[model samples]
Target: MTVQSKQGAYHTGTYRNLLLEFGYSEEEIQRRVLDNWTQIFEGGEDTRIYYESEDGLGYLEDTGNHDARTEGMSYGMMMAVQMDRQDVFDRIWGWSKKYMYMTEGENAGYFAWSCQLNGTRNANGPAPDGEEYYALALFFASHRWGDRTEEPYNYSEQARKLLHDCVHKGENNDGPPMWEPTNKLIKFVPALDFTDPSYHLPHFYELFAEWANPEDRAFWKEAAAASRAYLPTTCHPETGLAPEYSFYDGSPNHFHGFGHFFSDSYRVAANLGLEAHWYGLSDDLVQIADNIQKFFEDKDPEDYRRYTIAGEPFEEQCLHPVGLIATNAMASLAVPDSPRARAAVELFWNTPVRTGDRRYYDNCLYMFSILALSGNYRIWMPKN
Candidate 1:
């Protein structure tokens, strides 16, 4: 078990394989990880989300929506880099540059949040969560495979410039920044005033502080701390459920009607686990994970549903129950010693990647959870 007092993977270059700790064999873990990736990226029509374009680029489609999204694209890139699939990474990045990258608009330097299957824009605005993931995935790609002189292949430079634009978008009054300058909290979108708790990935920000443009390093550092402090506020004290959207002060923002726990909120548990695994756990963070695991320990996966932060269930069924299971399994990274944590990992290990119309999001979370538990999701730092 990982001791909370020990250094994080960032400092020590050592990661805990929780699946191994639970007595799973190394070969089984390896096979499970590979199988999950294959199912999502190369399986049959109903299974795979990735598609190779005629131009040699690739894109991951949101099968349920019949469109491609920056969310899936960025996630595919992250998975590709983590799996050491440089070909897939470059293909996805190239596709993103050609189809999603915005230019000569209020959203310049940002990727379009959604696009049709034919590469037409579905929306022109940017999602902060996608931008953050793209930046971090690019950085990891640069470290793992080294950057190239080509346009989008110059991964490090691309990541730095994107990060610069994220925090400085409105400096010349062009548009709103993704993050609020005063509070250091990332807004849900560039034009939005509120934030999504699931978008708060402090572990990524910590690395951004060290690898982002030198001028913006301090802001990234402060942003990391701010997020760590901010997360607990968004979580329900008893259930650890977070709203999909919230104000800068961490209060749920009901204006957008996404102020309840739902699909987006499912990422909160996974985020907390990954953050603790990469950067070590804190008391508050541990309690948040503990509460989440405890709340779900006895609940049937089939019964997962929309809920209030106070744990009140709605009549609506959860769209991605497997995603919820995967995230709860991931939360074990923070509270590995808890009995609830073990139950989560066991449940997740036995569950298969989701298939059908809504497979994209569920499978992505499933892959991440498996990689994380198997210690395959790692920090790809540049060799100094």
Candidate 2:
């Protein structure tokens, strides 16, 4: 069996293992990663974010809302796979397939965006972000652990099917495609004409180009380049804050009052950081991360709030300061020399995984930041 080597411009040897680079002992890194995962997925106290049903199904819930979201479930799957916890991955996948998948109707191959804990659908519509994560997680699972003969357990096939549907849904009159066919950009949702800036994950798209069905490989490649080029346009030239939603031309779309740097836009830095680390595409992203970190360097974390792309703070407070901090720290992976990058990492090191009603998003970003910084979040290729 041969493992695939890195194909991008970045040399693997230069990748920053931030924990080790920051003087963390190997033991300390292991302990912290495990401790964080345990608190999130296994803790018995109120801080535990995941719950398992009597029937063996498991889910990560947004405590603020009683509903289950595909975002959390797919994220749980990715985390579990990266941590080599197949049990956790399978449980979440089972719960998702049982409850969230829409097997019939316009969205047959797509998973529903939200559901009740008892396996009831809260919305039949699918979210494109969930589908993208689900596909990537499934592909990684297939590579890390050999696929089974079962339906949902057939990881590679399931991933291929999902990707096929993502790009081809409208072709068969099943539903609108998650991505715009002409531009190859991911939409906020299948029916939406605009996109979430944070949703353009070029790193994941790069891998998709290599692993997705042969017929669609070129499209995914174009998508990776399109997203890489689109990011700088969406982000502000000075502050580097991206809007939550934007048009195909990369201009902020204010149709739904989402034209500001808010909760969803926080992932832009994290995404750019990871993409740069994985593919060595740091030329433009480094400056962007620097600008973002510098913009927030003087602002107190306690006072972190929503802001216009131009850097004007909103009167409303931030909903996920921890998430913002985590992502900013993750961005440090792309911009290793920035003082603001170091400060962001230091602040994240001192902060604990959020616990309480709003901990879901914060903790998810926290875990990803932990994985990315420590060099644990990685691409798992199949051995052949």
Candidate 2: residue 198 lDDT (0-100): 91
TM-score result, candidate 1: 0.98
lDDT of 2 by residue, 97-191 (tens): 98899889888889999998888898999988899999999999999998999978999999998999899898978889998999889999888
Off by over 4 Å in 2: 1-15
Query: For model 2, what is the alpha-carbon lDDT of residue 343?
Result: 84
Candidate with top TM-score is 1
lDDT of 2: 0.87
What's the CA RMSD of model 1 in angstroms?
1.7
The Cα local distance difference test for each model comes to 0.91, 0.87
Highest-scoring model, lDDT: 1
Cα error, residue 97 of model 2, in Å, equals 0.8
